[model samples]
Target: MIRGVLEMGAAGFLPKTASPEIMMGALRIVLSGGVYVPAQAIASGSEMVLDRLTERQRAVLRLALKGMPNKLIGRELGLSEGTVKSHLSAAFRTMDVRNRTEALYAIAKSGARI
Candidate 1:
């Protein structure tokens, strides 16, 4: 896991703990051919082996990435907004993340690429 972190650092994979603002800032630097690591993340570990998400979680996440709100996602999935929130919470836990942005980042960084 540590090795994966090191390699990710070398290859530029930001951890899921990064705030959306920080992530966007880091992304700008990366896009300019520079690698940016958050100072607080220096001691953070790698995201190794994310178990495959359930079909429901994946469905919710797919819409979430498309910028859908939980209410809309629930409506589309024929689930309650509360149920969508629960699935999102479980997805965040399974992805080792805190927010939707971080989960999306982790998914991308982990090579799932949405």
Candidate 2:
């Protein structure tokens, strides 16, 4: 009841077991400047499943995807190999992944590849 009240306070309304017709009605109400959510719905948890990353992390992911060795990537980016490693490590953490392959895969899936 508290949750329902909270949602209602936010200007949204919904039924726990709405039929198709009720769903359409809710949509129409929402379209007319209301917010709609199912009663069973709760606030979304973990908006960011992955940690935020820096530009360097994004750069490292891009370079890794191009099959660039760390050393070469460092040279191209005008960074030291150790710096490249640091960026990649951060990228791995931000992507919630391990290893270059996983980082690359995550980047691709996230449409962050350059």
Candidate 3:
């Protein structure tokens, strides 16, 4: 459901169990043009999860985070576009996200250096 809401373009999601301060913080983040995800939804120890990414996957995500299209990322990395896509797909899975936007939110929430 959280993924569905995010996929539908919702700016944030707060579980009903969230405290008032947390709800307020989420609202502030959304108002500031950021996506808000509950910590549990992003998973604990996300840095370790990030570490599981292959170096190629990390390279792809670094380029993707820069807003590069897959084709451009491929050209820069000397990979085929299909290979770029594959790397991104694997990265998303490692990050437990369904797409690039969710991946970005998860990365931010995790406080990982990337």
Candidate 4:
């Protein structure tokens, strides 16, 4: 339900446990066209997750954040295209996002530097 609301541009995804005041504020923010996802939806303390990334995954994500294609990223990292895809799959799972773009969004939203 929360995910559906968020995807529909409802602006916020708060747990039912949120205070009334918090809900009101979230509603206002949503009305103003701002996005608000609950902390759970984002991997907060994401620097820890960042640190947990393998060196290759970090490199791959950084390049991906720059909009680099897999082929180019592989070339730069001296990894095969298959290896790059494998790394991307692992990264997507770790980041809890389905795709590269969502991964970047999740990482930034979690307050990670990159």
lDDT of 3 by residue, 31-100 (tens): 7555777756654443757889998999998767645678888999999999999999999987888887
Question: Of models 1 and 4, which has the larger lDDT?
Answer: 4
- For model 3, state the Cα shift of residue 69 in Å: 0.2
As for lDDT, the candidate ahead, 2 or 4, is: 4
The order by descending TM-score is 3, 4, 1, 2
Candidate 2 is scored at a TM of 0.50
Per-candidate local distance difference test: 0.65, 0.58, 0.77, 0.69
**TM agreement with the true structure for every prediction:** 0.55, 0.50, 0.61, 0.58
Superior by TM-score: candidate 2 or candidate 3: 3
lDDT of 2 by residue, 3-114 (tens): 3453335434456567988778667645654444442342233324234777677677566544467788899999999999998888777667777545433433343323
Best by lDDT: 3
The TM-score of candidate 3 is 0.61
Clashing pairs in 1: none
* Cα-based lDDT at residue 17, candidate 2: 69
Model 2 misplaced stretches (Cα beyond 4 Å): 1-51, 111-114
Off by over 4 Å in 1: 1-50
